[model samples]
Target: MEGADWLRTRLTSLHCATCGRSYRDGQIRVRAQRDGLSFVDFVCRACGREANAIVTVVGRGRAARLEVGELAESPPGARSPSLGPADVLAMRRFLRRFNGDFRSLFGADGRAGGRLGA
Candidate 1:
Protein backbone atom coordinates (compact mmCIF):
# COMPACT_ATOMS: atom_id res chain seq x y z
CA MET A 1 0.00 0.00 0.00
CA GLU A 2 1.01 3.60 -0.50
CA GLY A 3 2.08 5.92 2.28
CA ALA A 4 -1.10 7.92 2.28
CA ASP A 5 -3.21 4.83 2.53
CA TRP A 6 -1.24 3.56 5.49
CA LEU A 7 -1.37 6.90 7.27
CA ARG A 8 -5.09 7.21 6.68
CA THR A 9 -5.75 3.82 8.24
CA ARG A 10 -3.80 4.57 11.38
CA LEU A 11 -5.01 8.13 11.93
CA THR A 12 -8.65 7.34 11.51
CA SER A 13 -8.55 5.02 14.51
CA LEU A 14 -7.24 7.67 16.87
CA HIS A 15 -9.33 8.98 19.72
CA CYS A 16 -10.77 12.47 19.67
CA ALA A 17 -8.75 14.65 21.99
CA THR A 18 -11.70 16.69 23.23
CA CYS A 19 -14.18 13.96 24.11
CA GLY A 20 -12.05 10.81 24.13
CA ARG A 21 -14.26 9.37 21.44
CA SER A 22 -12.58 6.74 19.33
CA TYR A 23 -13.18 7.15 15.64
CA ARG A 24 -13.75 4.19 13.38
CA ASP A 25 -10.67 2.87 11.68
CA GLY A 26 -10.25 4.35 8.20
CA GLN A 27 -12.95 6.92 8.89
CA ILE A 28 -10.84 9.92 9.95
CA ARG A 29 -9.74 12.52 7.45
CA VAL A 30 -6.05 13.04 6.69
CA ARG A 31 -4.52 15.71 4.56
CA ALA A 32 -0.91 15.75 3.47
CA GLN A 33 0.83 19.02 2.84
CA ARG A 34 3.52 19.70 0.31
CA ASP A 35 6.03 19.99 3.13
CA GLY A 36 5.47 16.33 4.07
CA LEU A 37 3.33 17.00 7.09
CA SER A 38 0.05 15.25 7.85
CA PHE A 39 -2.92 16.94 9.50
CA VAL A 40 -5.54 15.02 11.42
CA ASP A 41 -8.65 16.42 13.02
CA PHE A 42 -11.15 14.94 15.41
CA VAL A 43 -14.15 16.57 17.06
CA CYS A 44 -15.00 15.90 20.65
CA ARG A 45 -18.36 14.24 20.94
CA ALA A 46 -19.04 15.52 24.43
CA CYS A 47 -18.09 19.19 24.18
CA GLY A 48 -18.11 19.58 20.41
CA ARG A 49 -14.56 20.88 20.56
CA GLU A 50 -12.20 20.15 17.71
CA ALA A 51 -8.68 18.91 18.12
CA ASN A 52 -6.16 19.43 15.40
CA ALA A 53 -3.18 17.10 15.30
CA ILE A 54 -0.06 17.49 13.25
CA VAL A 55 2.53 14.87 12.39
CA THR A 56 5.84 15.51 10.71
CA VAL A 57 8.34 12.94 9.57
CA VAL A 58 11.78 14.36 9.68
CA GLY A 59 14.95 13.23 7.92
CA ARG A 60 16.13 9.61 7.60
CA GLY A 61 16.96 9.50 11.29
CA ARG A 62 13.62 7.73 11.83
CA ALA A 63 12.47 10.70 13.87
CA ALA A 64 8.82 11.66 13.86
CA ARG A 65 7.28 14.62 15.63
CA LEU A 66 3.71 14.96 16.77
CA GLU A 67 1.74 17.83 18.20
CA VAL A 68 -1.82 17.94 19.44
CA GLY A 69 -4.11 20.94 19.12
CA GLU A 70 -3.00 24.35 20.33
CA LEU A 71 -0.85 22.79 22.97
CA ALA A 72 1.87 22.63 20.37
CA GLU A 73 1.85 26.38 20.03
CA SER A 74 3.97 28.50 22.30
CA PRO A 75 1.60 30.74 24.21
CA PRO A 76 2.26 34.33 25.28
CA GLY A 77 4.06 33.27 28.45
CA ALA A 78 5.73 30.14 27.18
CA ARG A 79 9.41 30.33 26.40
CA SER A 80 9.87 27.22 24.24
CA PRO A 81 8.16 24.24 22.65
CA SER A 82 5.39 23.09 24.95
CA LEU A 83 6.18 19.40 24.56
CA GLY A 84 7.72 17.60 27.53
CA PRO A 85 9.69 14.38 27.92
CA ALA A 86 6.60 12.58 29.11
CA ASP A 87 4.69 13.76 26.12
CA VAL A 88 7.48 12.65 23.85
CA LEU A 89 7.55 9.30 25.53
CA ALA A 90 3.84 8.92 25.09
CA MET A 91 4.11 9.74 21.42
CA ARG A 92 6.93 7.29 21.00
CA ARG A 93 4.90 4.59 22.63
CA PHE A 94 2.00 5.30 20.38
CA LEU A 95 4.20 5.20 17.32
CA ARG A 96 5.92 2.03 18.37
CA ARG A 97 2.60 0.35 18.86
CA PHE A 98 1.48 1.53 15.49
CA ASN A 99 4.70 1.22 13.57
CA GLY A 100 3.12 -0.95 10.93
CA ASP A 101 0.66 1.76 10.06
CA PHE A 102 3.37 4.38 9.91
CA ARG A 103 5.56 2.29 7.67
CA SER A 104 2.73 1.88 5.27
CA LEU A 105 2.07 5.60 5.42
CA PHE A 106 5.66 6.72 4.86
CA GLY A 107 6.72 3.80 2.69
CA ALA A 108 9.83 1.60 2.91
CA ASP A 109 11.91 4.07 0.94
CA GLY A 110 11.14 6.67 3.55
CA ARG A 111 12.66 4.91 6.57
CA ALA A 112 13.32 1.63 8.27
CA GLY A 113 10.00 0.38 9.54
CA GLY A 114 9.93 -1.26 12.93
CA ARG A 115 8.51 -0.84 16.39
CA LEU A 116 9.39 2.59 17.78
CA GLY A 117 11.99 1.38 20.25
CA ALA A 118 13.08 -1.70 18.41
Candidate 2:
Protein backbone atom coordinates (compact mmCIF):
# COMPACT_ATOMS: atom_id res chain seq x y z
CA MET A 1 0.00 0.00 0.00
CA GLU A 2 0.99 3.65 -0.37
CA GLY A 3 2.78 5.48 2.39
CA ALA A 4 -0.09 7.62 3.59
CA ASP A 5 -2.57 4.79 3.67
CA TRP A 6 -0.06 2.49 5.34
CA LEU A 7 0.54 5.06 8.04
CA ARG A 8 -3.15 5.72 8.60
CA THR A 9 -3.95 2.02 8.79
CA ARG A 10 -1.28 1.20 11.32
CA LEU A 11 -1.47 4.20 13.61
CA THR A 12 -4.01 4.31 16.43
CA SER A 13 -4.54 6.82 19.20
CA LEU A 14 -1.80 7.66 21.64
CA HIS A 15 -2.18 8.42 25.33
CA CYS A 16 -0.98 11.55 27.06
CA ALA A 17 2.29 10.98 28.88
CA THR A 18 1.57 13.49 31.61
CA CYS A 19 -2.16 13.12 32.22
CA GLY A 20 -2.60 9.56 30.89
CA ARG A 21 -5.42 10.74 28.65
CA SER A 22 -5.87 9.16 25.23
CA TYR A 23 -6.29 10.87 21.87
CA ARG A 24 -7.91 9.43 18.79
CA ASP A 25 -6.39 9.13 15.32
CA GLY A 26 -8.46 11.92 13.85
CA GLN A 27 -7.90 14.25 16.78
CA ILE A 28 -4.13 14.20 16.14
CA ARG A 29 -2.44 15.62 13.05
CA VAL A 30 0.14 13.47 11.25
CA ARG A 31 2.45 14.40 8.42
CA ALA A 32 4.58 12.07 6.29
CA GLN A 33 7.73 14.12 6.24
CA ARG A 34 10.09 11.25 5.46
CA ASP A 35 10.14 8.50 2.83
CA GLY A 36 7.64 5.99 4.16
CA LEU A 37 7.36 7.28 7.72
CA SER A 38 5.23 9.89 9.40
CA PHE A 39 5.86 12.71 11.79
CA VAL A 40 2.95 12.86 14.19
CA ASP A 41 2.02 15.76 16.39
CA PHE A 42 -0.38 15.08 19.21
CA VAL A 43 -2.05 17.82 21.19
CA CYS A 44 -3.55 16.78 24.48
CA ARG A 45 -7.12 18.03 24.62
CA ALA A 46 -7.26 18.18 28.38
CA CYS A 47 -3.89 19.63 29.39
CA GLY A 48 -2.95 21.26 26.08
CA ARG A 49 0.45 19.58 26.04
CA GLU A 50 1.89 18.60 22.68
CA ALA A 51 3.83 15.43 21.86
CA ASN A 52 6.03 14.55 18.92
CA ALA A 53 5.58 11.07 17.49
CA ILE A 54 7.22 9.01 14.77
CA VAL A 55 5.61 6.22 12.81
CA THR A 56 7.91 3.89 10.88
CA VAL A 57 7.43 1.01 8.48
CA VAL A 58 9.01 -2.19 9.70
CA GLY A 59 8.49 -5.63 8.15
CA ARG A 60 6.52 -7.10 5.27
CA GLY A 61 3.33 -7.56 7.20
CA ARG A 62 0.69 -4.90 7.80
CA ALA A 63 2.36 -3.76 10.99
CA ALA A 64 3.91 -0.45 11.93
CA ARG A 65 5.27 0.97 15.12
CA LEU A 66 4.27 4.26 16.65
CA GLU A 67 6.94 5.91 18.77
CA VAL A 68 6.03 8.92 20.85
CA GLY A 69 8.72 11.18 22.12
CA GLU A 70 9.18 14.76 23.19
CA LEU A 71 11.27 15.39 20.04
CA ALA A 72 11.54 13.69 16.70
CA GLU A 73 14.28 11.12 16.28
CA SER A 74 15.73 9.23 13.34
CA PRO A 75 13.73 6.12 12.63
CA PRO A 76 15.10 2.88 13.93
CA GLY A 77 15.74 0.54 10.99
CA ALA A 78 13.63 -2.37 12.24
CA ARG A 79 11.68 -2.64 15.44
CA SER A 80 8.39 -4.13 16.56
CA PRO A 81 5.65 -1.60 16.00
CA SER A 82 4.23 -0.03 19.09
CA LEU A 83 0.75 -1.22 19.99
CA GLY A 84 -2.05 1.02 21.09
CA PRO A 85 -4.96 -0.05 23.25
CA ALA A 86 -7.04 -0.79 20.17
CA ASP A 87 -4.31 -2.92 18.64
CA VAL A 88 -4.00 -4.95 21.80
CA LEU A 89 -7.72 -5.58 21.82
CA ALA A 90 -7.69 -6.68 18.21
CA MET A 91 -4.79 -9.03 18.93
CA ARG A 92 -6.74 -10.58 21.75
CA ARG A 93 -9.65 -11.22 19.45
CA PHE A 94 -7.40 -12.73 16.81
CA LEU A 95 -5.82 -15.08 19.30
CA ARG A 96 -9.22 -16.11 20.52
CA ARG A 97 -10.48 -16.99 17.05
CA PHE A 98 -7.27 -18.64 15.84
CA ASN A 99 -6.47 -20.56 18.95
CA GLY A 100 -3.72 -23.26 18.56
CA ASP A 101 -3.67 -22.90 14.78
CA PHE A 102 -0.31 -21.29 14.26
CA ARG A 103 -0.52 -21.59 10.50
CA SER A 104 -3.89 -19.92 10.41
CA LEU A 105 -2.72 -17.17 12.68
CA PHE A 106 0.49 -16.40 10.81
CA GLY A 107 -0.72 -17.47 7.36
CA ALA A 108 0.01 -20.77 5.67
CA ASP A 109 2.64 -19.12 3.47
CA GLY A 110 4.25 -17.30 6.34
CA ARG A 111 7.87 -17.68 7.41
CA ALA A 112 6.99 -19.94 10.27
CA GLY A 113 5.36 -22.43 7.93
CA GLY A 114 8.30 -22.29 5.55
CA ARG A 115 10.80 -22.66 8.38
CA LEU A 116 9.00 -25.67 9.82
CA GLY A 117 9.03 -27.40 6.40
CA ALA A 118 5.29 -27.62 6.43
Candidate 3:
Protein backbone atom coordinates (compact mmCIF):
# COMPACT_ATOMS: atom_id res chain seq x y z
CA MET A 1 0.00 0.00 0.00
CA GLU A 2 1.01 3.66 -0.35
CA GLY A 3 2.62 5.61 2.51
CA ALA A 4 -0.28 8.03 2.67
CA ASP A 5 -2.82 5.23 2.88
CA TRP A 6 -0.94 3.54 5.71
CA LEU A 7 -0.48 6.80 7.61
CA ARG A 8 -4.14 7.72 7.38
CA THR A 9 -5.10 4.33 8.72
CA ARG A 10 -2.66 4.55 11.60
CA LEU A 11 -3.36 8.17 12.51
CA THR A 12 -7.11 7.77 12.56
CA SER A 13 -6.81 5.77 15.74
CA LEU A 14 -4.56 8.30 17.49
CA HIS A 15 -5.69 11.44 19.24
CA CYS A 16 -4.33 14.94 18.91
CA ALA A 17 -1.95 16.01 21.67
CA THR A 18 -3.61 19.38 22.14
CA CYS A 19 -7.32 18.57 22.04
CA GLY A 20 -7.39 14.80 22.59
CA ARG A 21 -9.57 14.23 19.53
CA SER A 22 -9.05 11.25 17.25
CA TYR A 23 -7.82 12.15 13.78
CA ARG A 24 -10.09 11.44 10.82
CA ASP A 25 -9.12 10.37 7.34
CA GLY A 26 -10.42 13.63 5.87
CA GLN A 27 -8.26 15.63 8.25
CA ILE A 28 -5.08 14.14 6.78
CA ARG A 29 -3.46 15.69 3.73
CA VAL A 30 -0.43 14.41 1.92
CA ARG A 31 2.04 17.23 1.32
CA ALA A 32 4.69 15.29 -0.55
CA GLN A 33 5.61 11.76 -1.56
CA ARG A 34 8.65 10.11 -3.15
CA ASP A 35 9.77 6.51 -3.34
CA GLY A 36 8.23 4.84 -0.28
CA LEU A 37 8.15 7.93 1.93
CA SER A 38 5.53 10.60 2.49
CA PHE A 39 5.21 13.87 4.39
CA VAL A 40 1.69 14.35 5.66
CA ASP A 41 -0.15 17.07 7.53
CA PHE A 42 -2.96 16.61 9.99
CA VAL A 43 -5.38 19.36 10.85
CA CYS A 44 -7.43 18.73 13.93
CA ARG A 45 -11.08 19.62 13.36
CA ALA A 46 -11.73 20.04 17.05
CA CYS A 47 -8.89 22.45 17.95
CA GLY A 48 -8.07 23.65 14.43
CA ARG A 49 -4.38 22.99 15.01
CA GLU A 50 -2.03 21.42 12.50
CA ALA A 51 0.60 18.68 12.90
CA ASN A 52 3.05 17.05 10.52
CA ALA A 53 4.36 13.52 10.27
CA ILE A 54 6.92 11.60 8.30
CA VAL A 55 5.88 8.13 7.16
CA THR A 56 7.77 5.41 5.37
CA VAL A 57 6.79 2.17 3.63
CA VAL A 58 9.29 -0.67 3.76
CA GLY A 59 9.51 -3.88 1.75
CA ARG A 60 7.27 -4.68 -1.21
CA GLY A 61 3.87 -6.17 -2.13
CA ARG A 62 2.52 -8.39 0.67
CA ALA A 63 5.61 -7.76 2.75
CA ALA A 64 5.26 -3.96 2.58
CA ARG A 65 4.72 -2.21 5.91
CA LEU A 66 4.34 1.34 7.15
CA GLU A 67 6.47 3.06 9.78
CA VAL A 68 6.13 6.43 11.38
CA GLY A 69 9.42 8.27 11.36
CA GLU A 70 8.42 11.18 13.61
CA LEU A 71 5.39 13.06 14.80
CA ALA A 72 4.82 16.75 15.42
CA GLU A 73 5.85 18.68 18.49
CA SER A 74 3.97 17.87 21.68
CA PRO A 75 1.69 20.36 23.35
CA PRO A 76 3.58 22.95 25.40
CA GLY A 77 1.42 22.22 28.42
CA ALA A 78 2.67 18.63 28.50
CA ARG A 79 6.31 19.63 29.03
CA SER A 80 8.06 19.21 32.35
CA PRO A 81 7.62 22.13 34.72
CA SER A 82 10.33 24.75 34.55
CA LEU A 83 12.46 25.75 37.52
CA GLY A 84 10.87 28.46 39.64
CA PRO A 85 12.35 31.61 41.14
CA ALA A 86 12.91 29.88 44.46
CA ASP A 87 14.94 27.15 42.78
CA VAL A 88 17.09 29.79 41.07
CA LEU A 89 17.66 31.58 44.34
CA ALA A 90 18.70 28.34 46.04
CA MET A 91 21.17 27.54 43.26
CA ARG A 92 22.66 31.05 43.50
CA ARG A 93 23.06 30.70 47.25
CA PHE A 94 24.80 27.34 46.82
CA LEU A 95 27.14 28.72 44.14
CA ARG A 96 28.18 31.77 46.18
CA ARG A 97 31.20 29.99 47.71
CA PHE A 98 31.35 26.86 45.61
CA ASN A 99 35.00 26.08 44.76
CA GLY A 100 33.99 24.11 41.65
CA ASP A 101 35.25 20.89 43.24
CA PHE A 102 32.49 18.31 42.69
CA ARG A 103 34.15 15.69 44.91
CA SER A 104 34.44 18.07 47.87
CA LEU A 105 30.93 19.43 47.27
CA PHE A 106 29.51 15.91 47.32
CA GLY A 107 31.80 15.17 50.33
CA ALA A 108 34.16 12.22 50.75
CA ASP A 109 32.11 10.82 53.68
CA GLY A 110 28.81 10.24 51.85
CA ARG A 111 27.57 13.62 53.06
CA ALA A 112 26.42 16.30 50.65
CA GLY A 113 28.69 19.31 50.91
CA GLY A 114 27.65 23.04 50.74
CA ARG A 115 25.60 22.54 53.90
CA LEU A 116 22.96 20.62 51.98
CA GLY A 117 20.91 18.99 54.74
CA ALA A 118 21.67 15.27 54.37
lDDT of each: 0.53, 0.59, 0.74
- Model 3, residue 33: distance off in Å is 0.8
Best by TM-score: 3
Return the TM-score for each candidate structure: 0.37, 0.44, 0.52
Q: Among these predicted structures, which one has the highest lDDT?
A: 3
- lDDT (Cα, tens digit) per residue for candidate 3, span 1-118: 4656666776687677789998899988777888777887777889877777887878777787677666695353543467999999999998897778766666666478534534
lDDT ranking of the models:
3, 2, 1
For candidate 2, write residues 79-101 as lDDT tens digits. 23578999999989976776486
| Candidate 2 ranges with C-alpha deviation above 4 Å | 1-10, 61-118
Output the TM-score of candidate 1.
0.37
What is the alpha-carbon lDDT of model 2 when measured against the actual structure?
A: 0.59
Q: Against the correct fold, how does model 3 do in TM-score?
A: 0.52
Off by over 4 Å in 1: 44-48, 58-118
Residues 1-118, model 1: lDDT tens digits: 1255555555655665545667654444465544667765544455445555676545433344333334132224422347989999998997776745766655555554444324
